[model samples]
Target: MSMLSVLTSFAKRDFALAYRQRAELMQPLMFFVMVITLFPLAIGPSPEILQRVSGAVVWVAAILSLLLGMERMFRDDFMDGTLEQYTLSTTPLYAIVLVKVAVHWVVHIVPLLVLSPLLALFLNMSLPMYVALIATLLLGTPVISLIGAIGVALTVGLQRSGVLVALLLIPLFIPLLIFATSAIDSASLQLPYGFQLGIMAALALFTLAAAPAAIAYSLRVSQN
Candidate 1:
């Protein structure tokens, strides 16, 4: 089979597996909603306050939710020995890593994106802010997935590596969180946020170019 066929097969297999494990897949989305909902109760339902912090609150929830699901990105395949086969296969490991991460980002992030507008209303976000939030997430979430995949790949062989993966990744994610929130914050103020969005786009492009190879290497090292 050709490389394209191999990668497409990998994508289909992962998507089917994700469908079979729907409950496990929904955990992150539930966590994301819970986090956003709790903020109002904790902070006493002030529109100004909620609007001011909405970006940070949503971005933080998103990062945490993504991390909650990151551990399983490779563990299932690792345990089933499928990951080992991929590493040993003639099809390139980086391509497999890219497909896996792309599917994961879709499976986890799309639900969150769908729910974001409602959550934005819950947080008293203006239309401009909501638009910025979507823009930032579109550009930023993949960077989170790509970078988070590296941490997950490195720790997948270990028992109970969830905390370790978060510890390793949270610091890396801070820059993304800052840029995303800053973009939303600027929108709230009726200011242009292209600078912040530009930085996020650059980060996404850099990670997209660099992360697959790094994750492929990490998986090989972890499985050794």
Candidate 2:
């Protein structure tokens, strides 16, 4: 089969499994909403206070949502023999990983980006910063998803590895957090925002180039 055909096949299987496990899948989205709601409560009813903190709140909520959503992505396939077959197939494992990462980002991260504005309102985010927030998400979120795929690949079979995965990823995510927050902050300050946006774009590009290869190497090492 052609490379495109193999990726198409993998994409179908991935989405099919996600559909069958809809409730489990929705947990992350639900968690994001719930967490955002809790922020206002914990920080008191002052709108100013909430507004001051909303950018970080939305970003944290997003990270948590991705964490909730990633565990089953690689774990299920690895346990059920599908991943083994893929590794043994003629199709490049890195290509297969790339496809799965794309599909995972679609199902998991896209919703977070879409719903961010709504979440931002609850945290009292200012209206002016909305475009910067959305732009940051659009330019930066694929890196989050790709980094997540690496975490999933590394910890797929381990018992109680979620903490480990978080530990592994949080440092890597710091640059993302910095630039993402900076973009929104720039908009709030009425300073230039595109520079931060450009940084995020660069990171996303790097992740796209590197993640698939990293996942492929990890799978090979694991299989050995």
Candidate 3:
């Protein structure tokens, strides 16, 4: 079978998991909405305040939402003994994980991108800034999702794994968070955000190349 065919089947498994646990998929979406709604209450109703904080808030929410949903990418399969089966399958385990990670990004991160504009309004962001934020998210979030999958896969079957996962991920996530929020901040100043997007897009590409083999190796070692 072609790599595309194997990837499709693995991605379908992700979709099936999404279908079965509808609420799990909803958690990140709900978290985003709830977090955006709370900003006004906590910080008062100033447009300036909202504008000042919105970029960081959006990235923060994006990161947390990804964190919340990451475990589902592999932990359920690990629990059901399917992860081992995947390791033993004819297709390369890393290739299988690569597809699942991509699907996981679609499940968790894409909705965050779709909903970013709505959240941006609560921050009192202007149309230009809102557009920039959305653009940065489109270019940047795949890195977060892919890197977070590595953290998730590392601790997939461990008890009380939350703290460790965050620890593992924070170093990787910092660069993305910084540059993404910087892009939105640049938009606020009416500066060119294109440079930041370039940096973010590069970061995404780098993680795409590196994370799968790292995760595949981790899972294989865990099984030993």
Which prediction has the highest lDDT against the true structure? 1
Q: After superposition, how far is residue 71 of candidate 2 from its true place, in Å?
A: 1.6
Question: Per-residue alpha-carbon lDDT of model 2 for 1-224, expressed as tens digits?
Answer: 67788689889988897888888888999998998999899889898787777777778788878887777778877888888988888888899999988888888877777787778778777766778878877777788888888887877768877888888987888898888888888777788987888889888998999999998787666656
Where model 2 places Cα greater than 4 Å from the true spot, the runs are: none
| Residue 108 in model 2: lDDT | 83
Off by over 4 Å in 3: none
lDDT of 2 at 158: 83
Ranking by lDDT: 1, 3, 2
Task: List lDDT for all candidates, in order.
Answer: 0.95, 0.82, 0.83
The predicted structure with the larger lDDT, 2 or 3, is 3
Candidate 3, lDDT over the whole model: 0.83
> Over the stretch 47-118, how does candidate 3's per-residue lDDT look in tens digits?
888898898898888788778777677877888899889988989888898888888878777777777767
> Which of candidates 1 and 3 reaches a greater TM-score?
1
Which residue pairs clash within candidate 2? Answer: none
TM-score of each: 0.99, 0.94, 0.95
When summed lDDT is taken over every stretch of 10 residues in candidate 2, the lowest stretch is: 215-224
What RMSD, rounded to one decimal, does every model reach?
0.7, 1.4, 1.3
* Model 1 lDDT per residue over 83-132, tens place: 98998899999999999999999999999999998999999999999999
In model 3, the number of clashes is 0
